[model samples]
Each structure stands twice: as C-alpha cells, then as structure tokens.
Target: MSLLDADAHTAHIFTGAWTRSGGGDAPVVSPSTGTVLGRTGIADADDVREAAARADKARHAWAAASFEERAAVLRRAGDLLQAHEAEITDWLRRESGAAAGMAGFQVHVAAEECFEAAALASQPHGEVLRTAKPRLSFSRQVPVGVVGVIAPFNVPLILGIRSVAPALAVGNAVILKPDPRTAVCGGAVLAEVFHRAGVPEGVFQVLPGGVAAGEALVADPHVRVISFTGSTAAGRRVGEAAARHLKRAHLELGGNSPLVVLDDADVEAAASIGAWGSFLHQGQICMTTGRHLVHASLADAYVERLAAKAEALVVGSTEEDGAALGPVIDAGQRDKIHRLVTAGVDAGAELRAGGTFEGLYYRPTVLDRVTPTTPPFAEEVFGPVAPVVRFSTLDELVELAGSTEYGLSLGVITTNPMRGLEIADRIPSGIVHINDQTVDDEAVAPFGGVGHSGTGSRFGGTRANLEAFTETQWVTMRADPARYPF
Candidate 1:
C-alpha cells in the first residue's frame, strides 16, 4: 500500500506493528491554505514508555544479527526511499511547507543517509590493544540498546532518517518521536520503509507526539541514547534530561550562521551564494546564513545584488503555486520572522527588499546597514531574513563571524581559497565552505556543529555514526582464566 494511506496498519505509533496512539488525534494542517490535510494518532508519555520497552526487548536480537543482514536492510531502505521519492516529496511539500527543490533534496540526502549507514554495518568495529602480560586485549563497539530520536518539523525526513538509519545499522533499535506537526512525512513514511525493508518486529517504532512524549522518551530507562534535532532552547532541556538519566544525547541544535564575502570576491557571485544560503527553504535551516559579513569595499554592491535576488524569488505555496520558496512552517513562525524583521528595521537596519507577507507567504527580506546589536542579526531568526553588515579588516571579519553563540556552518567567498581557509581556521564552526553557501549537507560527511549548534559528536559519516550509536567495550582474555585475589 502507498505509505500515505491512512490505515490501522500504518498508524502514527508503530511498535512492532502499526497501532493507534494513546494520545488523541493531531491534525496535519497545511501551511499554505490553512486546510486540515489529515489527522494522525498522537502518542502520550505512556505510549513512549511502551515503545521504548518494545524496542529494548528487541534490541539484543537485532544486535546479534549478522552484519550482512543489517547492511541488507539499510541498503533496501535506501532503494525504497528512491522508489517513493515522488510521494515522499509531495508529503514534505504539503505537510512541512518544503519547497519542491528542498523536498527533493531531503529525499535524495535521506536515501544517501541509508546507503552510507548500510556501509557502516560491515566496517571494523574495534581495534586491537597491546598488552604487557601474556593476554589478548581489544575494544569492540556494541549497541547501546534502544535509541530515541526526536526530530523537528523543518527538514523533517532527513533529520530523522540520518539518526534512524545509523542507529539501526549499528545494531541498536530506534524509537523515533518526530514533531507532531510533521508526523506524516517524518514518522509514518519511515515506519513504512523499515517495515517493508524487513526490519524485525519491536525493533523500530514511530511515535508522533508533543512535549510530554519527548520528555518520556528521554526519561525511559530502556532508551539508552537520544538523537535530538531542534531549537537550542529545547535541545538544552533534552540534554539536561538525558544527563539525568545517564543516557547519551546527540543534539543537532539551532544556529545563527554567517556567510562572509571577502573584499576581493566577485560581488555578483557572492550575492548569489548569499541569497541561496539565507533564503533556501525560506531560511528555516539551522545552518541558514543568518548573518552576512561583507568586506567594506564590496558591501554596498553586495547588498544591492542580494536585495535584487531576494525580490525575484517567488514566495507562495510549493504544492499549489510551484513557488521557488514556500511558507514558514506555520503562523507562529511567520509571526516570529516578521517580528524580527520589524525589530531590526526599528533598531536602525535598513530594509533593502522584502519585509512583507501575504498570508503565510513571507517575502525574502534583506536588511542592510545591520549592526551586531540589530534584532535577528545575532539571533537564530530561522527565517528568510538576511542581515548584511560590513567588515573593514580581516580581524573585524573574523571577530564578526565568530561573535554568535552558534558555531554551526560558515561560508566564505574569496578570490584566494587559501585566504578563506585561513579565516575559517580562526572560526569555531563545525563545517566550513570556501566560495560556497552556508547550508550544505552530505550523508557521508560529518554533519553537526559546535557550541549551541550541536553536541561535539557528529551525526553523519562512518566513524561519527559508529561513535554516536555504539559503545566501546574492552575485552581481555588470557590462555587460562585468571583468578582475582582479595
């Protein structure tokens, strides 16, 4: 059956088999038209505990499965994702306000995530250690039992799948709690994929719920690890809760990332990169270019060009109008975006292009003459508002870019790539790009940030995934059993 079809066998809370949620139904409302697209079951705290118990019960057998078996399942899941790309993209566009291009990107990356995770299943899990005595000693990675993955509404599929695929491939069972707002695309689609890919019963579950469910997942004794992707405020709470439970929490949190256009860079090309960095997916990305630091010589031209690009972008409903940009996730986010823009303008930043909205369709806004003190300039606006400021020297540029609490992604446009690297060396970001935009991701690349942006451990790539999902155990063996003396 199609994954989107609402049925008892494809409900919101899936534990071994699909089942109705304990919490009441939650409506999936379309951002564009304010229409109720559908309704799915909502999971409460009790349901989260139940899911965790089931996942923990099934984890040992899953961990004992042959490496080939785990790899096969992940590989099949990647293939299935490509097969249902169209349907999944449609769901993302309708439910999460993802633009057509953004939705396709999510599907593509999510498939690659599965493929990369598949490769991880067969990689060497441990290293041999030298021992002075007549004994063999080695450390091997092992599953940490059940993992809880809490995902956000924006970029729902990729964020959730990145953690889910790796945890499952590394032999840990997963209980995914996608944001209730994006339950269908983030939760239901994944449940269908794993179920069809021959994952064992009780090994994976998708519980779509609100704060209570998320809190329960963290507190559940059976869930030993949590991979959470969301706002920094919420991530801190999750981290604190996970620490209280002694569970490992891998957090990919919020960012107010910067894109620096060096003095010698081509103004037109830099503007193009800046526009895409700040406006793609309506700038709802954690790695979106929230601050644009342009060298003083090129600042004026850069602002003009950026404003022009912002004006040209068609902001409307992706599903209905085939717009280049879509709405902010919902009304609350829309209000936040506008409020930040207004505050910036009032605080002395000049509105260069946008600053208006029609219904939920917010125009791509450019705020020039923006100071560090300007609203949204130093904050994670998480909207399509680009604030451009000038830097007179390399020291000023470095200081400006590194000022924010977030250290996620950094982009630099420069004539000399080495010069860009030198600047990046002084910054605290986890990911950096020369002559590229701030928002970029690869399934095989280590993806995460530093400081408030994320935990130090990354989510993607082989080494990172293995470390994130598995625990290392040191084993020592002698020719004969050694006796311990009191």
Candidate 2:
C-alpha cells in the first residue's frame, strides 16, 4: 500500500505469461527523495510481439461480448479503483512527486474514466443510411483490434486509463507501456484492476520499460492503433512510426497555453487562477498556463498579489502533512525550469518571487516584464513558474498568445462575458476558457490541443474516443433489386 515495493513491481504482469526479455531490470526511484522505491522488468521485442499477438487474439472474444458485459467489466474496474484509493494516494506521490491533492484527484479521474467509458460502451453503434433501393444500408463502428498505449510519468494513472477505458469499451485489447519512473504504481495498477475485473490474461499487459520496449510495441504488427501522451519530440517519433506502418495514431503532445487577463477583470481572482494553473503538479501538465498575458493597467497589481500567493504555497514531499507543493519529477526537470526562469530575467524580465530550488522542490516562481520573445514565455517552461507579460490592447494580447508554436489551451478573463468570449473565440487554441484557467479536464468533455500541442485528436467525450478507437464500415444489402446496367 505504501510506495509500491519492488516485490509488488509489474514485471510479473509481463513475465507471468512470457519470460522477461531484453533491457533487464531497472530501479524506480522516488523523484522527491531520490531513494529507490521499486524495480521494474523491461520487455524485449519478442515479449512485446507476443503480447500484441495475444491481444489480437483476445480482441475477438472481447469484441463479441455484448455491450452489457463490457460495461459490467468497466464498472467493476472503477469500483475496484475506488477501493484502492488509499494505496493509490500513498504510492503515486513517491513515484512521481505528486502532491496529495493531485494524487487524490488523479485517482478520482482514472476511476471516473472507467465509469464514463462503461456508459459509452454501446454508443455510436451504427446509423441508418438512405438508399434509393428498398434495401438496408448503415455504417457500423468496429474496434481497431489492438491499442498500444504509451503513457508518460506525469499523471500516468489518468493518461493510461483515458486511452485504455475507451479502447476496451470499443472491444479492443490494450498493451500499456508506462514510463519507467512510475511503472509499478502506474501501469501495474491498471493491469491488476482490469485482470481482477474480468479482463482476459493476455487481453491486458503492463510493460514497465524504456525505449527498447516502447519501440517494440510501436513496431509490432498486431498493434492496430497507438495513443501516445508525451513530449512533442517523442510524439513526433511515434507519429512517424505509426505513419510508416499506416497505423492510426492519436497524439496528446506538448502545450504552451496562455492565460489572458483583461483590464476590467478581477486581478485577485485571475491571479489565483494563474497560480493554481501554473503551479499545480509543478506545472508539468500539458495544459499548464505557460504564458500569462495581462493588461498593462493591472499587470503590476496582479503580479504583486500573485507573488504573495506563490510565496505562501507549501513545497515539500507528500509525507510532510499539509504540504501543498511537492518536488518536480526529477532534478533534470527542476534545473531546466530554473534555466528558463534565469534566461527570462537576463532578457530584462523581472523575477518577482521564489526563484530558488531545494532538492527537486523548486519554489513557485513569478516573473514579470516578460515579452512574447522571452524564453519562458515562448518555450514550454513546464515547472511551477509563471511569466507575466503586459499587453496594452486586446489585439496585442491575441497576437502574443498566438506567438508560440504550441496551441493546446488558452484562458481569457474579463468582467464582461461577451468580451471574454470575443477573445476566446479568436485565440488559436483547441481549448478556450472564458472565465476559467487552462488546467481543466472532464470525463465527458473532449480534451486535446491544436498545432504542436497535439494531432487535433480529442481524447474524451462520447464522440471523440468512440470515433478515434473505431473504424467505420458501411454495409449495404439488396434483397430484390435488379438495377445493374449492362
């Protein structure tokens, strides 16, 4: 229940069926403490191939299962996850340095994804088509057979389940490759839940591994689709491989989202939204507010209030009770965030508050006088750092918000609802929030990004996943027609 011991590692989830292949065993250290928490077994090409083949085989029975049967399994998985909430809360923090609030929320979202997928198991079956002849014609949705889910260490539970739930609901087997950092607690948890919830042995596999295992899964012939959530560079590689194999790929890539504040908006409320959106999860989220564009008239007051709020946040390990902020995933990420913040200051931006790090725990940083060209503003400084830039006019803000290569999410704040809507409507982002911050995700809402952020593929909602994970086939029947021309 605590830290997911090496004895509880997910190696057996793969080796219980096939012998552990290449890449050998590796240790999973707590990102917050730098202490080894568990060990994970890596799968080789043969192992990945075997799992894919079995998944393909398993799909036939799972696909043939009635909607009610599939829904029952999913609902059971959700209930089981809820039962394991305490364990989840304990290990997720150590594995990935998630705060208590985040770890709890991640469990809630993962369980909810299972339930939502259960309810949508029977949707988008088939639609009747109009035919000239007195014959039946319709289009039906069919599963892609096998889904290769490659999830990141950040919020692995939510990311992995989001793909698995929908893929399984549509009657497809899933092969999950979780990041090595949180393998045991992240990937194994899903495997354990589904296996206990009635999914077949080979129907689901948890491979806690590195590049070799991931490459094997991607290159496997039986893998019909790939749902990848990670860095844009890595995602591009996955996209290329999927393209080479002509496999369907839905990518949830990087984001450099902006939170815009208008002159007439509430500065305190906007600052609170900004602090939470940027600092939550140490700003490791793809939908994190990377750029903060505020009107010049209120930028000073907003940054002043935001700095006080950031300073008050507690930064420590989850073990320390009441700690609001935890360490970053690793020292490397923390250093990179620090570098970005330093560069922004060198470029004439002002470091308003908390620009230091102790271990992996980087304090919430606030930067003002940032411009569209500033490194922290332009690049995805995915750490607990907020770059506040002043814009004189709405047109200026819109242009600054769109200056980045990424366009996953945008937030607009204004007293006038219509004014906020006007700005949100013009922003070049997949998700636009009129009064809310950018870090928002719902089980039923379609969630994704545009431009460099993603492949424009929505991951949630009834229509998005049902369409993404399935192939439509149009069938036509002619019983008594004789209309062929000679």
Candidate 3:
C-alpha cells in the first residue's frame, strides 16, 4: 500500500466497535525517509472524556467477570497478534522507522506479554491467613478502575502492550493515548487485536491524539490510575494531574543512563554492547545509555574502539538489511539532537566521531571530555549520541554516575566480578547491569527505575502492574460483638 494511502486511513476502535476519527488528522511520518505512513486524529478534550467514560462504564462488567473469562480473551488476543505479526511489524517499521529485526522483536515482546498476562491471571492473588481467634483475613486483588495509559512513540507497541495486557488481565478497563506519531502502528493495531478477540465494548479504548487529549485523560476523575511513559517534563505534568484527583500515577520518564567501564574491563566487548544499546531505535529509548564513564587509565583506548565501532554502524533506512541504526522520529527531534551535540562541542568536549545529520538521519555520535557541565552529559540526549566521561577512581566514577537526576538504569563492564558487584551496589539506578549495556531487558525480571526515572516496575513475572491497577477490600464478621467491642 502507498504511504499516503496508509496515512489517510484511520483505524479507530472503541467498546469493541471500530470507526475513524472525525477531526483534523496529523500525518505519521517515517523517521528514516521522512515519508508519511498514515494519519491519526488530533482528538479533542471532549473526545478524550468520552473515551474515559466508555472505559469507566465497561469496568463494571469486566471486573466482575471470572478470571478464566478474562484470561481467555487475553490468550485469544495473543493468538491474533501472532497471526498478524508480519503486518504489525511492517507497520511499526514504517511508522517508527524501526529496523525490521527491531520491529519484529517488539512484536514478539508484546505477544509474549499477552501470554504472560494470561498465565498470571490464573494465579492466586492472595493466601488465607489463619489466626488463633478464628478471624478470617484474606487479601483479594481487585481492579482499581479505569486506567489511563500514555505511551511514547519509540517502542510504542512493546510498552503499550506491556501495560495494557496486565491491566486488562487484572480486570480493569483501559484508555490508551498513543504517541500521535505512531498511533497507527501501536494503538490502531492493538484495537484490531482486541476487537478480534471478542473483547467487550468500552473495555479497551485507543484514543489517537495530541497533548490536549493526554491532559484531558489524566485530569478526568473517572480515570483511577494513570500510567505514562514519556519525557521527564511530560511525566511531571501527568503526575501533577493525577495528584489533583488523588489518583495513582505510574511514570516511566526519561533517562540519562550511564555505562561505567572499570579499569579492569573488557573494552572491546563494552564498546560493542554500548554501541548497540546507545544507537538502537536511534537512542530514543528511556533506558538507553547516554553516558559512558570510563576509567581514566583506559579512556583513550576505549574511545578509539568505541568510535571505530560507531562509525562502522550502518546508518540507513529500516528497509535495508544490515542496517544497525535508523533515523530519529522527525525533523524536530533531529534538530534537538543537533543542538545538544553542538552545545557539547562548544562546551569544550572533543567530538570524537559520527556527527552527521541529513534530514531526519543523525549519524551515531561519540564525544569525549564530557563533564557534568556539558549538556550532553547532564541532559537526556534522546538520540543516537554517546558522551564519554573519564574518571580516575571508583569513588569518582560512582559519584559521577549518581549525579544525574535520572536513576533509571546503569551498566558496568569489568572483568572483576567483585568490583562489578561493589559498583552495582553503589549506583543509584533502579536496574544495574554488570558486564553489559543498559538495553538488556528481561521479560520475567522486574524492570523500572527510581527517582525521576519512573514510579513503578513494568515486568518481573510479578503482578505489579495488576496490583497497581487494583485496590484492597477488608471484610469482617463477629460471632460475639461484646468480646470485640471497642
């Protein structure tokens, strides 16, 4: 299908029903080629309220349904996802400018989350506690109410599905406000799967729109909990809105993650892993490592190796094979990255290699002599750029790594296991990886950050998301009121 043709179509699903949005449409473009893939609506505040109310109404029946019933629906959704994996991957590649392999990986991850939620739903929410007085107390996990999810453009499907599946499996209706840039690939496809899975109307709603829609969703009293994955600034806004309603808010914000290389480390392996981790999705991921803290002893050699690897990376369109990295989401993001890199150069940091920007394509960048004063080191550079900072001692390195406001994820590469463990303990990040980069995420492991990174965990095989979307109720009965009188 033609890119313009795709852009003109809208895939809207609400309450198990499908329709297109009635409003001015925003074009979704490929970051690699600047080609329009599809257009989604810039939904108004009223439309967002309607979507939230629909979910609020559907929550009653959905929450009251049996666990088995919910599990069946999620499992069927998983099946539909698998059957349409190729098409979904194509859409992601076109809309997000994601490499084919990366797009496929995201689809697989989302599908796996569906199955994980299904399996988890059958498990017990609590265990009965026996007491001497024969007073029965058992905690039962229940849905909190309508959940509001705001997903980012990068990794839209993976993150969205991760949050949505668990929320639905736990019996809460969901309202998803996808990144306007990738709604067609992320929210639209998800709506299709939910509809085919026979989900009840209003149980799952995908609102494709802009900031106004997001503000409306978060501010709505009907939305009991808000789960947002985006920039630190946006996350703060969402949290504040949730606070107004005294609602629970889950924020997965931006990261300036650090990769520490100890003196006794494998420089080559670290460089390769860092290259992939930093450049994947053009460095758009929240957990992507943005800083490289190398022991001063090995700083020179490490930069040389890292620079060579980064230069060797194939920067091209997602459709091309052997392309390690693609373009940024758009000209705006591209320009932002350029300004940050330029500022870093002006701040006296040496531009080691790969500082090329043509349209949306930004060549992977590696800078040296970056200190806390440099914008590239202090701010979250959400592009294919890496800043190398040299530290002399372990204490200095630890202090430097912990200086950032974000405590999302950290990576340490060293041959000494004891030293690696010691550094991991000192890092303030929520997740610490030894001998690898920060991009290595496991489906079964608890994944999230601390401080400004995020508020809650995403994975870990635990029902964390389910618990976040649920509340506890206490019930009591007294055989002898006089014995237990206050």
Judging by lDDT against the true structure, name the best candidate: 1
Question: Which residue pairs show backbone clashes in model 2?
Answer: none
In lDDT terms, how accurate is model 1?
0.91
The global C-alpha lDDT for each of the candidates, from Candidate 1 onward, is 0.91, 0.86, 0.83
Better of 1 and 2 by lDDT: 1
**lDDT tens digits, residues 1-486, model 3?**
222233324544343555556446787777767776656766678877888888888899988998899899999988888888888888887788898888999888888888888877777776676655656766777788888889999899988888888889888999888888888777888887876787798999888878888888888988988888899899998899889889988888889999988888877888888887788889999989899999998889989998998888888888666677877888888888999999999999999888887778899999999999999998998999999999998889888999989999888888887788788898888888888898855556677888889885754466665567678765554566536456
Local accuracy of candidate 2 as per-residue lDDT tens digits, 1-486: 432344555445452243454667777788777888767777777778878888888789989999999999999999989999988877888888888889999999999999999998977688999998788999999988999999999889999999999899889989999898887667877877887788876777888778887888888889989999999999999999888998988999999999999999898999999999899998999999998899999999999999999999999887557888888888789889999999988999999888999998899999999987788988898899999989998788888988888989989888898888888888889998888899988889898888889888569999999888899999998787667678
For each candidate, give its TM-score against the true structure: 0.98, 0.96, 0.94
Q: How many times do residue backbones clash in model 1? A: 0
Candidate 1 local lDDT, 1-486, one digit each (tens) = 465567553335778777878897878888877889888789999998888888878989999999999999999999999999999999999999998889999999999999999999999999999999889999999999999999999999999999999999989999999888888899889998998999999998999989999999999999999999999999999999999988899999999999999889999999999999999999999999999999999999999999999999988888875599998888889899999999999999999999999888899999999988998878898999999999898888888988889999999999999999999999999999999999989988998999999897569889899999999999998999777895
By the TM-score metric, which is better: model 1 or model 3?
Answer: 1
Q: What is the lDDT of residue 347 in candidate 1?
A: 98
> Which scores higher on lDDT, 1 or 3?
1
Q: Which window of 10 residues has the lowest lDDT sum in candidate 3? A: 1-10
